[model samples]
Target: MRRPGSGTRRLAGARVPVRVRGRGRDHGSAAVEYLGFLPLLLLVALAGVQLGLAAYAAQQAGTAARAAARTAAQRERADGAEQAGRAAVSAWVAQRSTIGGTGGCPGDAVTVTVTVTIPSVFPGVDAFGPVHRSATMPCDESN
Candidate 1:
């Protein structure tokens, strides 16, 4: 037997309270949990993007270094090695990069070094520093 408008039911003439599962007690819990975890998820995503940017910057630095070294190896283009290095990378990367090197045609080889600051996704955060890459090329004996 059961009573109307009551949570209890009669079993063998004894009243027992009905136990409810996953009712109003847990309402909106998922939304709350998701809200709590949202910040962490965003942070992880931002970190991944930042890491990718750093890798790109490193790759750009390497390209710049190689371009500069190759240009410096030729006596006729040695003076434009820095300009050549800057032109080899993206505008954004070149804007924050520095190129320096030694050696030229008379020498056995030419070496060039490029340093670029890693761009940050987070404002005012510089957790990752500059990326540096160096390259060497044989001098052009004919030049």
Candidate 2:
């Protein structure tokens, strides 16, 4: 008689095959694992893209605010401040953006604020909101 997988002993009549643990049950497990991780991978990708969009929106808001404030500071820029603000940002951002200002007088300081909505790149996710930026400049008193 011989033990399974034991070379020290010899069998006289017949041979026996050794059974491996988890050999049959482990099939297709890799595919299952990949499927389980698919959602998490998708989440990470979406988060990365959404973060980029939010950052771009914030940058655009700052640019718009600066342009608007600069124009508002000029005494003759009463009607052009908003236009400048809108023009300073990307068209997609401008479509969903708002520009406003306060305290731009001949002798008064000017403050311009720009707000842009940060669009979500992930489907069914609306956690991100609008980004706001403000700028101030001295009004041109020489007007």
Candidate 1 structure quality by residue, lDDT tens digits, 33-106: 99999999999999999999999999999999999999999998898899999999999999999998844566
> How many residue pairs clash in all the candidates, one count each?
0, 0
TM-score for each model: 0.85, 0.77
Quantify how close model 1 is to the true structure by its C-alpha RMSD in Å: 2.9
Candidate number with greatest TM-score: 1
Candidate 2: tens digits of C-alpha lDDT, residues 48-93: 9889999999999999999989888988766688889888888999
128 Cα displacement, candidate 2 (Å)? 2.4
TM-score of 2: 0.77
- Positional deviation of residue 48's Cα in model 2 after best superposition, in angstroms: 1.8
